[model samples]
Target: MEDAKPMLLVLSLLVVAILPTLRANIADFDEVWKKRAEDAKKASLEAYDPHPERVTQNVNEEVHEALEGDDGKRRNLKKYNGPCTATNPIDRCWRCDQDWASNRKKLADCALGFGRKATGGKDGEIYVVTDPSDDSLLDPKPGTLRYAVLQPQPLWIIFAHNMMIKLSQELMVTSNKTIDGRGANVHIANGGQITLQFVRNVIIHGLHVHDNKAGNGGMIRDSFDHFGLRTRSDGDGISLFGATDVWIDHISMWNCQDGLIDAIMASTAITISNCHFTHHNEVLLFGGSDTYSDDKVMQVTLAFNHFGKGLVQRMPRIRWGFVHVVNNDYTHWLMYAIGGSQQPTVISQGNRFVAPPSLFAKEVTKRGYTPESVWKSWNWRSEGDLLLNGAFFVESGSPITNLDTKDMIPAKPGSFVARLTRFAGALACVKGKPC
Candidate 1:
């Protein structure tokens, strides 16, 4: 009993010492949050695309022309002579260039869909990450990924070599940053996940992020000017909270503890493209809550991705907002795919959905927390989508008119998806050679 008293006193003293720092961090973050919230609101408003279907049509035409010739006829790949057979427009922009290593910034212009304007760190200097360790959160080493992302200035971050980074806490990324993991094999696995909170204009490409675990957070540096006490993190592969103008492409992910990618808390103007997802549940979530009505302004584009085997449900279960699910390949799902609630607008176009052999779960759409009377008015439409093996999509709301069809239904059919997503997921890029 006498020794217990000393231990209690020691613990109380430690708490007393830490309280001041925690309080200061909280106060500082309050101020930062206010400013960031305003910035995110303004950016999201400016970045929202009301007619994103036009962009999808443009890309579809490009992909069609690439696979078939300009004469709108099919071509035999066996007779092709190009250095790289880039199937899609985004990949065609940089994949075939021999000098891609030296001109890496050119990739910023390759983004399409709602996030096309996210020129992440394109005008900023290149910052190479030579260290794979996240030893310190407050005073991170100079050449580490933590340091590269925290800098207030825009930076194009690339790796020095093939490396695996096991983070100790959630990696907080700042605005105007690009984590480009090309020309090297980089993996973020078996540790903490990534968090993009209250930032804008970020691009993450060409990496494998899997096996993520939740982080017990403390004081973590979000930017060079801000370090705050963060709480325990959700174990998502990537979490976007109140962020805008973000693009995530060419990533291969599986076995995360939570949703593979989540965009919530009014996050908008984002794109997830050319990625491969497998062995995950609740694959994507757009809105965190049904009551968070501010998510009505959210707009996202899911393009040219491959949802492979071992996936269960929520190939993006949305809540409120506008989403364009375009030109993707879905080969497997144990449960219903592409679900929603709260009267969101979802337009599924030019995609392929192959249902599992089980007849109980072949439906493509699932509406939650709403009765048939309410959800029947929601704008959920599927155009040019291929449903194989008894798969189906339940569409609702008013029939689209010719005026609306002019802006909405120009995308190619699902038959083109096989060629469009042929090179999905991360690619192996060698210097002086095509990817």
Candidate 2:
């Protein structure tokens, strides 16, 4: 028994001595594993192609021509140049121009006094459209006398669902026009059937635009057609296009099929601050279709916004512009925080992102798809992929540079309360006022 015990001890020592060598071998194998992972990551990034065709081409050119006129030259007219009237310093001239183009036609009609006045007064006098008879707001009968009195105050179009006033086509607004809804409850239900076309210098604020879905289903037409294509019964609560120096503040957007807010074409110098955005496809998007290339699309700022739950799609999808996204809270996004075309430089700084593993799980389950499948479909990488591959994976093909995540407020997964605090803090700073 004693001899057998000595033999057993010797065997144990031998195994221990060999163990280090075995570990060394394993370490060598680990290097190979790391190399393979890195190679795979490189391949994945290379393979990722957004199928640029899916993006409408030459959209910028068409939109520019439509808005700026055919010579591709901007008018230096003094009427077009001025600081915005909004109290926020971030609001600027370009937004005013964009607003003008969006609703010019509508304001022209109002200025000409073509519609029946719910309140009888001289033509061109400011009136309110509170009922279904406001079709006069869109197309007034010919020879409708131009209103003799120009109301110094902006016109207000208040639409209740029962009003049945279909104000769908894009309204071209005149300069110094403002359209205010009394409150967020003022609903425009499913008026998406109309196409709102070219106009300028208008403001549509403090209204809930839901189920105003209009647009051909993802078809490529003229740049205007792109508007119709992206249009959904689920259109944004408020949308600004081809205009500049505009302001959208203190609004809430939820459950919209598209972005909560979007700006396209040569739109520039816009500011979206102090807004609560959630439950939508995207919070914001900048730049226009791929076909256009102009430097003016740059210089937009999205700051001090609160983003949280019910958002089931991308965050800010941007392209061909310099977008400053700062000091916001983004929680529970189904996909990337900021993404879009390979062009345009996006600066995302001082924003907090609070996502839990469970949020990812829930998002995956809601889509009835696995995380791997989603990654494959979008050609995206997961955070864990960094463990296998190197951190270099983040830099590959990333259009956004100067991204700052440090000092971001952290929150647990699915903790809406924590998200709100983070968002509130950021919003406070951005608005330069109380949250």
Candidate 3:
């Protein structure tokens, strides 16, 4: 074992020497990242308020008051009396229409919370992906999924048939693109994952993204006009790097090498809704590092998701941001769920949390290494959540009062979470019927 130390040192030095050769040089990365970061900070601060969830609470209170009966038992308010029972407000916006396939752009208008303004490809032409192969990282074929996402013009991309696309490199998506997988069973697995870097106004819906592996850094095209050298990926299923106004809905993700979804580097104004996540360790991560103080402007909404079995922790572990965790179903976790650091604001309202059977880990929140003296002032609140199986949440900071509710939308209650998230994952939708 003493003689083998010299060989190990030689191997480590050789690996370090050869790593830089794999990177292809792109001259404009710093410029692009800086510009996008500035824009994201501006947009996020414009939408920021001290108590962001105040609007949601006001709307919910008004709704209950209007539906109250003579005997003080609240009557059920049937917002959508259609054939299909779309329980949640997001699903009720468009799921009841029989012509959803023809009017596919209408889904862009149905987003709530911070991502409500993300109009992905709403004014663009429809581009159907006829090929599922991602054989080339640069100069892809015209009818391939890679080509459609790299086009300069805004596109509402759809699949022609059921396909299992194995990407050879990271799929770098451009701005103003919508990849809609409603009418087919589209799966992106067993290879590189999706990357949204320095882009905005993008929506990804109805896809299965799982089983990803990191790729060796190489030259890849991000848009029609440009291609850049990418570093080795971290293997997240969906990575948002300096991205804003993004909406991800109805994606089934599991078994990735890193977090299932990661939004970092000042990414804000995003919503992740109605997704089914299972069989993963670290689930979601927002605000990558504690020292990235620009993340103070970050704001996101995690709504109506089903955090199912085989998960460990970080059903978002956030830093320096305001996160509205509303109406999600947390049924399993091996470790503590919903962690944070760096004085972030978390408003957990109307969620169901069923703790794991472990007696050592029954708490729902973990404030990462920070002492009580430092973290006691952080605004972390739990309102109207259903805690079961000896679960508990640690609340801190003072509650806000008399917030202006001029134009705000309410999030649904956690009592109806089972019904609201009944169709959390990707759905099998026929062309003419309601989805």
| TM-scores for every candidate against the unseen true structure | 0.89, 0.46, 0.87
Least well predicted 10-residue stretch by lDDT in candidate 1: 19-28
Give the per-residue lDDT digits (tens) of candidate 1, residues 1-435: 987999999999887556432232232457777788788878777777666556656565666655555331232424444568677778888888888998899999988887778998997999999999999999999999999999989999999999999999889899999999999999998888888887899999999999999887788888898788876677889988888999999999998898899898788989899999999988999987787788887888898899998999988999888888888889899988899988988888889999999999899889976899999989888888989999999999865442253544355667777767767777778888877
Candidate 3 Cα deviation (angstroms), residue 141: 0.9
The Cα RMSD of model 2 versus the native structure comes to 23.2
Task: Please list all clashing residue pairs in model 3, or write none if there are none.
Answer: none
- In terms of lDDT, the best-performing candidate is 1
Ranking by lDDT: 1, 3, 2
lDDT of each: 0.84, 0.37, 0.81
Per-candidate total of colliding backbone pairs: 0, 45, 0
**Candidate 1 ranges with C-alpha deviation above 4 Å:** 1-29, 68-83, 400-409
**Which tens-of-lDDT digit does each residue in 156-216 have in candidate 3?**
9999999999889778888899999999999999888798876888999999999998877
**Candidate 2 error regions (>4 Å):** 1-129, 132-175, 182-184, 193-200, 215-236, 356-435
